[model samples]
Target: MLKPEIKVLDVQGQYRIHTEFYRSDTAENTIILVNGSMATTASFAQTVKNLHPHLNVVLYDQPYAGKSKPHNQHQKMLTKELEAQMLLELIEHFSANYLMSFSWGGTAALTALACTPRRIEKAVISSFSPLINGPMRDYLERGRRCLADCNRTQVGNLVNDTLGKHLPSLFKRFNFKHVSSLAEHEYAQMHFHIEQVLTCDQPCLLDTASGIEIPVLFINGAWDEYTSASDAQHFVQSIENSQFVRLENTGHFLDMEHKSASHISKAAMLGFLQPAHAEHLAASR
Candidate 1:
C-alpha cells in the first residue's frame, strides 16, 4: 500500500484545503481526482490506490467538505466560479497534467476548462451536465428542504427515490442507510452545496462549455435523470475534441457502482488517461 503525503493548502489566505498526494516515481503524469459535493479526500481512497501506480494521483477536500475549512463559516456557499479558480491554483501548484471529475466536480472542471483550456492535457468527467433540467432542480430543492428540516429519513427517501433506485441492488440499502445517517457537518455541507447549485446560473455555465479546447471524455449513466445521458451528450457537442460514453444500467454514482460496473467505469477512464490515447486524441484535433 502506498501512503499518501498529506498537506493543507492556504489558497490566497481564503480557504484551508486539505489534500492528499500519491506520488509514483515511475509515472510521467499527475491526475487530480476532484470529489463530488460534500465528498472528502477519503472518498477517493480506492480510486487513488487504483490510479497511483499508473499515474500520480492527488485528492482534496473542497471547502466545507471533510477537513477543508470554509472561507467563512457564516457563509457556507462558494460559487462554482470561485471553485474553478481554486482548482486552477491546485493544478498550477502541483503541476498536474490531467483531471478526473465526478458529479458536482464536473461543474468546477468545466468552468476551469472554459476559462483556461490549455492548463490540462486531458480530462474525464462523469455524471455531470451544465444544464440543470426540471427534475434535477426539483431534486436539489427537495434535498435542501429535507436537510433544512433535519429530516434524515426524508433525505434518505429522496435519494433512494431518485439516484438510489438506479444503483445496483447490492448498494441500494447501504446507500439509503449511509445517506440517512450523515454526520451533522455532512448534512450542513450538503444543504449549502445544494443551495449553491440551485442558485447558480445554468445557462451561463452551459455557454462556457463552447470555450473548451483540450481533449475531454464525458461518461454518463444511462439512467441518471439528474445529469442525464442526453444532457451530457448535448453538452459534449460544444467541445471540439470530446467524446461521450454512456454506461448501461449505471446511474449517477459511477464510482459507487457494484464491482463489475465499477471496474468498467474505471477501465474506461484508465484507457482515456493512457499516454498513447491522449496523444492520438490531440493529433486527431
Candidate 2:
C-alpha cells in the first residue's frame, strides 16, 4: 500500500532510466519486471503488491518511456540489442536474481539471458514474439495510421477488433469492451513504440534461444492476438530447461485480465521465482 522508492540511474553514460526498487521484509530473492510498450512501472502495480510480501521486486521505465528520459528527441528507436544492454546494466546494478517480462520485454530478457545465462537465476517471459506476423503487422500499420491522426476512437476500435479475434470462445460469446483510452502523452509514447515496432531490426528470439542455460517459464494467453500460443510452445520446446503454460480464455495484456491485475500471471511468476512456494501451494492443494 505504500509508495515505492523511485530512483533514477544514468546507464551507458547517456540514458537516464527511471526505476523503482521494493525491498521485502521476508528476505526472499529479487525479481525484476520489464514492462511492455504500452506499460510503465504503474502497470505492474498489482503484480508488485502480490510479490512484494515475499520477494524484493524491481520495475523500471524503458528509455524515453514512462518517467525515463531519452538521450534526445531524435534518438534512435529502441532495439532488442539496446534493451538487452540496458537490462544487463540493471541486472548488475541491482543484482537481480530473476526477471519477469511481458510482451516485447520478453524479447529483451531472452536476449540478455542468452548472451549471459548467469546474469539471473531464472526468468518468466509472457506473450513475447521475436518477429511480427502478418496479422500483427497489419494491426500495427492500422494503429500507426490511427495514432498519427490522434484518433483515439479508431485506436480503441482496432484493439477491440484484434483482441476479440484472439479471445477464447467464452470471451467471444460476450459483448466486448472498448480498450482504455490513453492520455495525450501516453498516446505519443505509444506512437513512438509503434514506430520502433515498425523498424525493429532485432532477430527472432529462436535464433538465440539455444544459448541460454537457465530455467525459463514461457506464459502465453491461449488466444493471444500478437503471438500464437503454438509459438510459445515451440519456444519452450527449443529450450531444454524451459516450460510453457497457456492461460485459458486469456489474450494479450494478461495484466488486464483482472481489473486489479493478473492473478494468473502472478501465480506463474511465483512458481518460477519461489519453487518452494509453488511446491507448498501444490502440497496444500
Candidate 3:
C-alpha cells in the first residue's frame, strides 16, 4: 500500500484545507477525489488504495469536515461558490489532470469545471444531480432539524435509516455505531453541510453545468433515491461530452454499498479513468 503525504493548504487565506496526496511514480495523471457532504478524506481511503498504483490521487477534507475546520468558526456554513474556489486552488497547486467526485462534491466539481474547463482533462462524478428530489430534500430537512435540536442520536438514526439501511448487516451496525460516536462539532458541521445543500441554487448550478465541455463520466445508482437515475441522466445531458452509468442495486453511497454493487461501481470508475481511455477521449475532443 502506498502511503499518502499529508499537508494543509491555505486557500487564498480564506480557509485551510487538509489534503492527502498519493503520488504514483509511474503514472502520468493525477486525479482529485472530492468528498461528498459529511464525508472526510478518510471516506476515500479505499478509493485511494485502488487508484494510487495507477494514478496519482489527491483527497481532502472540505470545510467543516474532518481536520479542515472553517476559518471563521462562527460562519460554519459553506456555499457552492466557496467550495468551487477551493477546488480551483487545489487544481492549480497539483496540476491535476482528472477529477472524481461524489454526491455534493460533484456540485463544486461541476462549478469549477464550468469556470475553467481547460484546466482538467476529464472528470468522473458519481451520485450527483443539480435538481434535488423530494425525498432527498425531506431527508436533508430531517437531518437539519435534528441538528438544530442538537439531537445527535437521532441524527445518527436518520443516517442509519436512510443510507445505512442499504449496507450489509454487519456493516450496517458498524455504520450506526460510527455515526453515533461522532463528536458534537462534527454534528454541527454536518448540519451546516445539509443546510448548504437544502439552500443551494439549483437552476444557477444547472446553468453552470451546461457550459462544461470536458469529457465526463457521470455515475449514479439505480436504487439511489437521493439522486435518482433519471435526474442524473438529465444533468448529464447538459454536458456536451458526457456518459451516464447506472449501477443496479446501489444507493447514494456507492463505495459503501453491498459487495456486488460496490465492485461494479469501483470497476466502472477505474476503467473510465485509465490513461488509455482518457487519452482516447481527449483525442476525440
Candidate maximizing TM-score: 3
Q: What are the per-model C-alpha RMSD values against the true structure?
A: 4.2, 4.6, 4.0
- For residue 74, give model 2's deviation from the true position in Å: 5.6
- Rank ordering of all candidates by TM-score, starting from the highest: 3, 1, 2
Report the Cα lDDT for candidate 2.
Answer: 0.73
* Candidate 1 vs. true structure, TM-score: 0.85
lDDT of each: 0.79, 0.73, 0.79
TM-score of 3: 0.88
Error of 3 at 136 (Å): 0.8
Q: Which ten residues in a row are the worst by lDDT in model 3?
A: 69-78
State in Å the error of residue 178, model 3.
4.2
CA lDDT of 283 in candidate 3? 79
Q: In terms of TM-score, which candidate is stronger, 1 or 3?
A: 3
lDDT for 137 (candidate 3): 86
Instruction: State the lDDT at 189 in candidate 2.
Output: 60
> Regarding TM-score, does 1 or 2 come out ahead?
1
lDDT of 3 by residue, 187-232 (tens): 7767776776677777766787887888899898887888877888
